[model samples]
Target: MALQEYTEFITELFESGKTHSEIATELQRIGAQSCSLMTVRRFCSDHNLQRRNFVSDESLGCEVLSAINQTGPSYGRKFMTGYLSTLGIRAGEGRVGRILREVHQPYNILRRQGARNLNPIPYHAEYMGHKLHMDQNEKLGMFGVTHVLAVDGFSSKIVANVTMPVKNNLVIYNEVYRAAVASNGMWDQIRVDHGREFFLSLYVQEKLSQHRFNTNRLPYKQTTSSKNLRVERIWPEVNTRVNYPLKRALVDLVDTDSLDMQDNNTKYCVFNLTCQVSQIGLERAVQSWNAHRIPGRGIPNTLAAGGCPQRISMELLPSAAEAARMYEDELGASLSWASAFGTDPFSSEEDRQQAEQVFLQEYPDITVLFDRAVNNDLSLFQDALLCLINATNRFA
Candidate 1:
C-alpha cells in the first residue's frame, strides 16, 4: 500500500498519542509498504500533524497547578506527565518535575521520603480478559463500610468496584463480578482470595466456565489475599485516597460521642450515610486511578477501554440482572438487595417510606449532605444523625 494511503490511519494513532516510531511500527504491522520511523515523522511534518504542547513555561505551570489541585499533590513526575498527556498536553518529565518541585515542595519532599521499597512480583496475562482479580477491603468495616473491587489482570484496570456495609456474596456477584462481565465481557479465569463473600460469584463463574474464550484454563482460582497481587496492589491506593480520610471522619464521630454505634437506629443511619459518602470517594479514586498512567504500561482506562480483544461471546455472557436470576435458580433462593445498611430504621416498608419522606423533607438535598460529609465536615454527620433520629421517632 502507498504511504499516502496510511495517512488517515497514522493520523488516528497520532491523535491517540502514539509516537512517530509507534505509528510507523503500526503501519508496518498493518502491511504498509516502506513505512519507517523517519518516513512517519516526515509524513507528520508534511501534514502538520504534531503533538500538543504547552506554549510557554507560564502556561505550562498554570496547567500543572490546575492538575495538582484536581488530582491532589500525590502525583509524582511521571504520573503528572502521563495525566497531562491524557488532557492533550505533552510535557517532558524533567519540566514536570521541576514545576512540581517549585510549586509543591512539601508534597515532593514527603513523596520522596515515603517511597516504599519495591518488591516486584512476576505476573502475566495473554490478553485483557485473560484473568480477573477480585478482593474486598474492610479498612472501614468497623464503621460499617466495606469495598469490593474487581481488576483486570492484563490491563491493570479496575473493571468494577462497589461500596457496601459488609462483604455480601450476592452483592459481590451482582455488583462486582457480574457488573464486570457485563461491561468488559467474560474473562478466561477469575482469581480471588478464599473469602466466602466470593462463593456466589465463583459458583457462577464455574457454571459458565465452558463459555470462556479460552477454556483450557480453569474458570476460577482461589488463593491467599497476599498472593492475589493485582487486586491487592490497589488497596494501598484506595486506603490513601478513600479509606483513610473517611475512617478518620468516622472515628471522630465515635471519639466525640456523636455517633452511637451500639444503638440499632444509630448504626443503621450511620451505615447508610457513611456508605453513601464512601462511594463518592471510591468513585473519584477509581477515575483518578484509571486515568493516571502506569510505568511500562499505558493508562489503564486507555488500555482496557477497548473491550477485550479475546472477548468471549457476548451472547453467552449474562447481564447482571440475568446472572442474579440464574443465581437464584441454582441456589433456590432470591438474592437479598439489602446492603450493609440492612433494613431501614422503621419497622416495615411503608414505615420506611414514610421515614424517608420525612427525612427528605427536612434534609431536602441528599447530594449536598453527602458532599459535606465527604469533605470531613463533622457537623453534617451530626445533622444527619439528628434528622434521622427525628424521622424514625415520628414513624415509631
Candidate 2:
C-alpha cells in the first residue's frame, strides 16, 4: 500500500522525533499500515521530513542555550539530547555534549563529576497506579517555600504537585492527594515519609483502602525520605530546575540587605511571590520531565496517559466535600482550607488589596519577573521589595 494514505499519522509520529524503525513498528502494531523500515525511510526522504536537513550548528547551539536557560544547566548530554528531541530537534548526544561544553563548561564539569550515590534498594510496581510516592521538598523551605509532589511508581510520572509557604496538611490533602485521585483515579498504595503533614492524606487513603484495586497490600506505608526512591529521586531535579536558582536570587536579596527574613510582612510578601514563581518553574520542569523519553522506559506522560488497570468508577471514590467531612470526623476539628500562602500578608484586608494593587502596577507578569530574577537581575527583586513595602506603608 502507498504510504501517502497514512501521511498525516506518520508525519505526526516522525515530528514527535520517532525513528523510522519505531514509526514503522508502530504502524504495524496498530495494524494501520504495515510498511518496512526502508519504505518508511524512503517515504520520509521523499517528503523532505528529515529532522536535520537544513538545520545549522549555530541555530542548534541557540536552541541548546534556550533549553539550558529553561531547564537549568544540570541536564547531561543524554538527557539534553532527549529533551531536544522532544522539541523535534533530533541532535545526537555527542553533538549536544560538544555544544553543552562550549556553551556551559562550568555546569557540564560539575554535572559530570557530581557526587551522586545510587540507591540499590529494589522496588516493584505491578502497574501504572500500583504505587504512589508522595514527598515534600524543603530545599527552599528556608525561603518560606515548600513543594509537595506525588509520583506514579510504575510510570515515574508526577501525578500531582503543589507549592506552598509551608507543608500544610490540609493543602496536601486537598491539592496533592485529592488532586491525584480526581485526575487519575486511586492508587493501590501510597508511600510517604513519616511526617505529620501527610496525616490527613494518609487518613483518607486508609479510609478508602477498601476500594483500592488491590487490597492485599497495605493502603499506605511511611518510611524515610531516602527510602521513598520514586519520589525522592525527583528532588535533585527540582533543586536544580526550580529551587537553587530561586534560592540564589533570594539569598542575594538578603545579602544586599534588601530582604528581611525575620520580618513578618517581608516574609509574607517574599513567600507569596516566590511560591508563585517557584510553582511556574516546577510546572515547566514537570512538563520537560514527563515528555523526555527515559532510557529503557517510554516517555512518562505517554506511559501514564492510558488510565490504570482495573479502572475504578469515580462514584466509588469520595468527593472533595466528602473528604472534607472525613477530615472533620477524624481530626475533631473543622475542615479548613487555610494555608500560610493564602493568608493575608498585610495588616488588614484593605492593606492587602492596596499592596496587591501596587504590586500589579509595578510587576504585572510574575513569570517575566521570575525569568529576570533567574538571570541575575536583582534590580527587579529590589524594586519588588520596595513596591510591596511602600504599598503596605501607604495603608498603614
Q: Give per-candidate clash totals.
A: 0, 0
Each prediction's TM-score against the native? 0.73, 0.78
List clashing residue pairs in candidate 1. Answer: none
In model 2, the clashing pairs are none
lDDT of each: 0.77, 0.80
Where is model 1 poorest over a 10-residue stretch in terms of lDDT? 369-378
Which portions of model 1 miss their true places by more than 4 Å? Answer: 1-73, 78-96, 312-315, 318-339, 347-396
For candidate 2, the per-residue lDDT at 181 reads: 83
Candidate 2, residues 364-384: lDDT per residue as tens digits? 877765665555564675577
> Which candidate ranks first by lDDT, i.e. highest?
2
lDDT of 1 at 232: 86
lDDT of 1 by residue, 78-117 (tens): 7677667767777778788899898878768867887663
TM-score of 2: 0.78
Model 2, CA-based lDDT: 0.80
Candidate 1, lDDT over the whole model: 0.77
